[model samples]
Target: MQPMALWKRVLILLVCLWGIAAAMPNLFYAKVEAHNDAVAAIEAAGGTATAEQEAARAEWPDFLPSALVNLGLDLRGGAHLLAEVQVEDVYKSRLDALWPEVRDAMRDLRDQVGAVRRAPSPDGILRVTISNPDGMTAALEAVRALGSSVVTLTGVGQSTLEVTAEGNDIVVQLSEAEKQATDDRTIQQSLEIIRRRVDEVGTREPTIQRQGEDRVLIQVPGIGSASELKALIGTTAKLTFNAVVSRTNDAGADPGPRNLILPSMNEDGVYYIVEATPVVSGEELVDAQPAFDQNNRPAVNFRFDTTGARKFGDYTAANIGAPFAIVLDNEVISAPVIQSHIPGGSGIITGSFSVEESTQLAVLLRAGALPAEMRFLEERTIGPELGADSIDAGRIAALVAMGAVGLFMIASYGLYGTFAVIALMVNMALIFGIMSAIGGTLTLPGIGGIVLTIGMAVDANVLVFERIREELRSQKNPFRAVEIGYERAMSAIVDANVTTMISAATLFILGAGPVRGFAVTLGIGVVTSVFTALLVTRAIIEIWFRISRPKSIVV
Candidate 1:
């Protein structure tokens, strides 16, 4: 066989070195992970680091590659939660918000419809009554004008609202198509908000994805507990600036027809009755940051977008000396009298809040409100101890498999078996290197795939060696026998690998979570083994033959 080209030999050497270097950080996983976290924290702190953070950062070499293969929830152990989004709540909120527009439309036609007032209605319907029955036609036409075209793929041609006259009352509700579209939008918004909240905490490899029509599955790796995860995401954080109606200490006070009662967040046994419609809602808030108020107390400073700024400016300008409540999730956080026309759209919220609470509230507000409420269906916390045990078991299994394979190969072919063993080690290193480069997560099944790869890595060598034995029996030269052996075994090796690659691809596409992790390692191992087992072993044998120049050899 012709000697391997110098370029090819150098390329092989470079690839092997790269794999080993990439895999080296994983051996000191905890130290490197701490270093990464410390670096991230320092960067977030604007280059200011605590003594502990500086110590952690110094533990690992700065010049070494730090990218590591992520460990999945099953291996890292964190929190899992399945939540069902209350899409109907958004339907009610959207419908309730329509009352202002409807009232405004009919008010412009007061000469025809007379005085208009909102009537008591259910969650998803808005009913308005007028004094004059003869104005029913005018009212219907005015309300219908408020309806807009539904902007969705399936509801493009449909109107967002259905307006009808029931006696002297003008009733309105979302159309069927609009309801579907709203449900989709609400679920999507909730998913994004939850993802933002989780990412804000710097947890790694979180799986925040929609499950079905209204369910979301959340798995956050490296979080403390399920309760902690739920606390972080479960808070609706719905903020509104409502007109203050009345205040009371009674637990069961009756609010007026268009007013609602909410308990005070700062005061015990206190309540406030606020108007249903908000002057501005949290949806228009563009930014919120934790800060100190005039009293040096923890507060959240907020800035509004252009639309919110105009509304806020007009309301504060008109309602000077009148108390307007800042409500969060139906609770009155504060009721402050408007001192002046708070013009710049920037305001501060002061309450009895600790620094930690204020910071978390700022994060939640910045992430934006969840369009609808979420009821958690399930909550589970996997302990890191269990993950440690799994990782240890996987490590031991991989080491045992490698050792057993190496011993078996060495006993079988003597010198060439040693070559196979060396190539097998390189194969494992290359698998890890590929995973690290791609930021792949490793699970228990992935470890199993790695162990299985140990066996498969030597299969090609076994086939070629058997073929070489056959050629030797027929009295061929050593070099010629080795050449024919690899050539004859190439077809079987290719067929086996082709089928395996197909299986790995299928699993990766169809499977979720840990199954996909298994597929990733198996697929990567298949490729690396081909390089190390068939090609690298051949290269090693070639160098051995060139050095010895043996004319006769024992198989």
Candidate 2:
């Protein structure tokens, strides 16, 4: 047998050691995972670990890699939601924003388009009537001038607003280009918000992705139910600072056309009429935390970005002794009088809130509000019992496959087959090690893929063994036969595994969820199996041959 170079021998030994070390955490999965979670919690809290947490952290050594294979929804059990975003909700907001611009532009053409009055129209349409009918064309031009070009690749050169004249009235709505762009932004923002909310709860491996233009798909493992997940993400949290016009006890009060009446969250009979335009938006908020007020009541403390701080400072400075409403999702959370200038852009929101409510509110504010409301179209909760049963079944199947494969290999070729069996064990370890290293998730189908890989892993060894038997019959020398066997089988092994890898790549690219999980395990298995079969097995055989110095070998 030809001896391997010192560097190659060391490299092979190091790889084997790494695979063993990386795969060791799985032996004590619960303890290791608890340790990792405790460390993460302590870090997130920006403090030292508690006694219990420190004990948990000490359970696993810091010198060793603690990453374990992430379990997929099928194995971990969690909540799944398919939510559809209300993208049209932004249209009215956009048009309302355009009102100020439209009014200003028409003010420039006051001589041509007489007095322009805003007439209430449908949800997405903004209607303005000019007293002079002959000046309708000029009014259309003035409104169209307020529109800017759409910034999208497909929408370049197209105007964001669609303006048309019906009789003496000028109608405005978002153009198709603008609507599409808005939908994309809304879905993306929704996905980000959902991710933040989920991550805040410290869940492992939550998948939040955009499904379509107006839909999002969320899968959170280890969560209690779909309703709980929904509660975390469903709140619009649309916080705004609107100028308070008046506070009334009567619910039927209509404040003017440019203002809005919102019901009080705390008081049943109180309502506030506020200006439609918000001085500062929650989107400008950078940080929020749960804190106790001076009166020892639960409250959410918030800090704003530079732009918001300036706007808020200016508004507060100008409106001392006047009331301003903090609006959340069209409901007036509180309407407080601006007693003094709040220049630092830091404030507390006080209401009849519990500690839990304050914490949830802070989390929502920090996560940023969803751009639009989400209606859950589909919801599901997977129980942990089902996942446990699946894991048990997969574990039993793997054990059975390993036993059968080992017995067959050992019975066929004795010492050499034992070497192949050992290589096979290393191959499986390396598969799991790589998966854990890469933070790949393991699902039910992923277990099936692993089992399938176990059966296929020995194919290269089988080819080499068969080739060795043929060479032995012709050459009559054990060392020469082994050399020729490996050389002859390399091409076939490479071709077969490469083709299978291509198939796994296709599955990973086009498949979703469980199918992709299976593809990941399968692909990793192929690469590891090839390495173990060719290098690891050959190294073991060479070492054995050198030690034994066998003149003749039995096949």
How would you encode candidate 1's per-residue C-alpha lDDT over 395-450 as one tens digit per residue? Answer: 99999999999999889888989999999988988998889989888988999889
Please tell me which predicted candidate would have the highest TM-score against the true structure. 2
Q: Tens digit of lDDT per residue, candidate 2, span 49-70?
A: 7899999999899888898998
TM-score of each: 0.85, 0.90
| Whole-model lDDT values for every prediction | 0.91, 0.90
Clashes of each: 0, 0
Model 1 scores a C-alpha lDDT of 0.91
